[model samples]
Target chain A: MDTTWSAIFTEMGWGMVTMVLNLLKVLIPLMVGIELLLHYKVVERIAPRLGWLCRLLGVGPKTIIPLLVGLLLGVTYGAGAIAEINRRTPLSKRDMALLGFFLFGCHGIIETTYLFWVAGASALFVSVLRLLIAVLVTAAAARFFRLAETRKE
Target chain B: MNAFTKVIVDGILRGLKTALMLLRVMIPVYLCVTVLKHTAFFGVLAGAAGPAMRIFGLPGDAVVPVVTGIFTDEYGIVAAMSGFAFDKAAITTIAMITLCFHSIPVETLVTRQIGMPAWKMTVYRLALAIATGVFTGWLAGWCF
Candidate 1:
């Protein structure tokens, strides 16, 4: 019994270390890159050009911030940005719903790409697949269900 | 300490702190996954998920997150994926579909916040995810 317990403990400990190290290797660099991009206002400049695309999915310009952040920082960071935006802007229920849907798949692009690449998959395929899915799912939700209707004024 | 040196020191310390915090969270997550795998809980989950998982050409284990992803998010699915030894194409396809539509809890909550029915959103997202997974997987298999 003791031996079994020790074996389990060891496996768990090793797995924990491996997971943590892997996550850090990806996260730290991505965070720094995102910070630099934001500092340069590069994302902001690019947001407008993507405006037509965003509109097709029924989200306003302001929604781009969280999407960009989420795409770089992962879900928690995206949620944090959305919460902050909600606090500051009083986004309607519709917008928040849309934001939530958008974030469902959001993760740092380079980070996820790298992770997938390391896992022996195609990074470009993963990145493009994620983006396409988010757009299609969000659009379908908005159109077929009219989920935006319940937005509180 | 000179000003430039002090700034660099501060930045390094901040990075270290962040790294430590991430370690704290990741440790528990890894343990949970490992334990789930060893205890055969994952197998049971896979078995239960057999029906839904079939659509994605995944074993029953694939169902746990495909179903859970409906409630939680893609992270849960990704976490689940960490336990498997899937081939590159399979992994890409799985990740693609999961990323496309996973997270039942968040989705349900958001839809409810907007006054949409939670049940409806749940069904729709699951169906969409399954459809996308099937199409993508088939396409990937054909190409590869």
Candidate 2:
């Protein structure tokens, strides 16, 4: 066990530093840019426009706040934002399930977009495909489960 | 409202909203990254599980999320994916599979909180995730 531990540590020691540095490089700019955007209320105006579209996927306009946040930020943050919204507005189980499905396909947009870009793929293609898949899958799941019918009155 | 003023107001508000929303997200994400880095246990587990992961075309170090799913959840799995270096097609396929079913502990807990049966959610998520992973991986490998 000791030998195994040592071997693993030796290999990953360098990776840990690189990982930390890389994470900071990506996250710092992301946070700063996001802060700038929020300070200007960019997402606020965009949210209403997306409401009609969100409804088709079985989510309310309220849910779009976290979905957009998750896309711009990442999943953990997205989930955190949703949890906060749910606390205040109280989402239904059906809505939560739908949100889960939507998130499964499309969170961490910027990070994933950058990754695709670095890999020689079109970032727009990746983003659009992910959103398309998320919407289609969520819609199918919502329909299959009769989520709308199961909603609390 | 005049066109120029409306445009300026819209742009300024939009920018502010986006920034605040970003700050909200960055705090939690930064914490997650920090904890993941300092933990020695994750590296050990990843090493131990390395052999089994290779069968799926993942690196030996890739077992961290699989192991994490046994205890915590799939968020760790997604975090793990962010740390690796696979081709675009491979990463997307793996991510799809992971997103479908990787965080057993977390998914089960959340589903139960929402009143779904944990066992059913587990079985359903796992089965769907594996099926999706295999199919997508094969298709991606073939096409790309």
Candidate No. with top DockQ: 1
Number of the top candidate by TM-score? 1
Question: For this target, which candidate reaches the highest lDDT against the unseen true structure?
Answer: 1
| RMSD for each of the candidates | 5.3, 8.2
Q: Give the TM-score of candidate 1.
A: 0.69
Off by over 4 Å in 1: A1-14, A80-101, A105-108, A137-153, B1-19, B39-45, B64-79, B100-127
Q: Rate residue B42 of model 2 by lDDT.
A: 59
Candidate 2 docks with a DockQ of 0.12
